[model samples]
Target: MGHMLWPFGTTWRPVRQRHRGTVDLRWLSARTWTRRWYPQGVDLGEWQGRRTLAVSWFRQKLDGTHLASRVAFVDLERSRHLDVLLAIDEDGMLQPAPIHAGGLAWFGDRLFVAATGRGIWEFDLSAIRRVRGAEARRVAGLSGRGVRASALVAVRTRVHPIDLRCSYLGRVFDADGTPLRRVLIGEYVTADSGRIAEYTIPETDEGRFEEQERFSPGLPRMQGAVRWGERHFVSQSDRMHPGALWTGRRDALERDRVPLPVGCEDLALDLDAKLLWSLGEHPWHRVVRGIPFRALGIDS
Candidate 1:
């Protein structure tokens, strides 16, 4: 087992409160104060209420095809990770397939994962029974493991093929309890003069995209995005500096930036705790950053 490191210099003390069987995470300010390690590769993360989910993928060449890949899910609250291998029907055998999930959305009892430039994979959480006391296995070889998808839908982004790079995907409900799929995508064309522009593409159904609303908060290099109430939050970073969390209104161009320990690859909001969460990648360890809502002038 790897030791948990408090990289930002603040000691983490137990809060004496636990949600279900998982312990609550603590932080001092808007920084990457706490760190933990998982044996899987995660490029993005999502948080809802008390649950935190991390997603990772593998891409390799198999046979003559370059589409051999799989998606891994890490249940941070339970300290467990599950690898769901992508497979296709070649003859009668289920051959390993490629499904590069870049974002994750957990709505109600459904889990939706979006592919890089392809489509979405919807999973029914109620259909998956927790497997205890067993180590994680690749889904391609498992017989009884419940990893079937409820549906796979294509995403018809309005951006051109040269500019259609999806950073993350999420779902939010309206005041009337109606659900909508919100996609955060953008393009970074050039290196020296390239500017990062983030936009929100809303779609109620699959295979279509609505009019995109571009964010003009002046923040560059958007790695992830999510919405809280009517506010839009994005994780930004540059080559010379670490990333930070920027909060602004959906209908305005102004924003407030909160500094973080490292550049974030993805962002999520824990509504129950009123905290903004971020995940960063390192060759040695995976880091998690937390910032309270009050830090960004938002009332909890």
Candidate 2:
């Protein structure tokens, strides 16, 4: 059984701080509910200067039958209705890109999605019928060619085009796929026994939220990550750290580890107002809201 190396997510609940940080379920408005969305590979995208979100759904088994995997394009305000796109598949069975998908990015006029073995797939929502998938080709001497790409983030937005690629061990590269830097995700105590950084990314890539930062745990596997304004949040599915939502800010540059909701997999936010939306995995695991958790006098 070959499985992608990931974090051992926890199955726990919110802790009471001396109130384990503040949790206001009201902060999240379950505004609209539609087809149950198994959201993976989440991020903010821009099409025509407007905000749109692209997410891939996990293969679902309904009534004991398997469902094909597809990508759902959502418009934030309109109706939250989903437009599904079928990805390239050889076996016709659903094999989703990594939960933490790397190939999807808003480049030029389209969204480029990296499939498991496909090099890159471009989708032009403006011209829905013009979607294109670039065949995966091997570069001589590259041991990890055509394998699944786990993550991709274009930090600079322009010239630098700094993109991060983590196929096996996390590594950084330029826009053209030339290797630049490398990072390891294991929680290895450095030669000095101190926790070495897992993935150090350029602040700019984190959005105008250059104030925000992104990184995985030294421990293998992470539930999900979201960046808003100057804060980046991740859910650590750990029993020991049940409902753990790790955070990092830019200005004060401090890390605030807060208690999140169990079963949370995706973190979304309206960062401007200090609001957060965490999507969960279970039926009863609805979205959790974090409203200015710190200012509310909540501490873990």
Candidate 3:
């Protein structure tokens, strides 16, 4: 809603090809079962000199109850992972966060998770608590060595009173390809077109998002969206069939739709690695995979 506004123009098209070059994530067996927890959002960052992936997962049950959410931190080079439970500080007590963590974005030491219908919950990566002994067991039946993490605070709660289904922290480049600071928030819709908005990231510790542009992208069932330079990539899935990636420019109407892995949700772009990471949500077949930009016919 300022001078930094950019038009949100995009439309869906039929799938043209499939991105077959996907790098499967090596996940722990207990975390791969979707009946227990379904993976949603994904983002990659360097933590302690190691490339790591932070994936948000929500508890899955048949009775429409969301218990708590957890984030899986995977060491990319080592192919190992750790699950840390997400909690909220209620007065002085720690309670599980029960929102549908549909998307995530890692910026600096802060991790932003989308809370459906609410706003974004910000967590401090440096403040992840180590739970051991009785406290670990009491929290989530851990064997005295589990980890528990809590949100530092919730931000952007007063901005969008409607649904905020997905999020991504990416740069909006200028005409010469110079990167500019921006964060994009989007929604998922099955019946009609979905909307996406871009905001300037707050510099203060309050972490409020100043909306710059908003529009409906005409992409129904959108699970995630990310931007690189002038190009925007969106993932849309219906849970049963394989997902599709819609690639286009912010000022263009034509989009190249390509087939993605089944149950693909949120998207994260690793520019250094030239890979686009995503997560699959099906039970017994859940996966965290990185598809090459070449496979999507895009340069990193």
The numbered model that scores best in lDDT is: 3
How well is each residue in 168-216 modelled by candidate 2, as lDDT tens digits?
1122223333333222221112122212123333333332201122333
Error of 2 at 278 (Å): 3.1
Higher-lDDT candidate of 2 and 3: 3
Best by TM-score: 3
- What stretches of model 2 exceed 4 Å from their correct place? 1-37, 47-50, 62-67, 89-127, 130-216, 226-232, 239-242, 249-258, 268-274, 288-300
lDDT of 1: 0.43
Residues 174-225, model 3: lDDT tens digits: 4344445666688877854677887776666765677887767777788887
* Per-candidate TM-score against the hidden true structure: 0.56, 0.44, 0.80
Query: Deviation in angstroms for 173 in model 3?
Result: 6.3
Estimate the Cα RMSD of every predicted model relative to the unseen true structure.
10.3, 13.8, 9.6
Candidates' C-alpha lDDT = 0.43, 0.35, 0.65
TM-score of 3: 0.80
Off by over 4 Å in 1: 1-52, 59-83, 86-100, 119-163, 173-183, 186-219, 250-257, 261-263
Query: What is the TM-score of candidate 1?
Result: 0.56
Error of 3 at 143 (Å): 15
lDDT of 3 at 242: 81
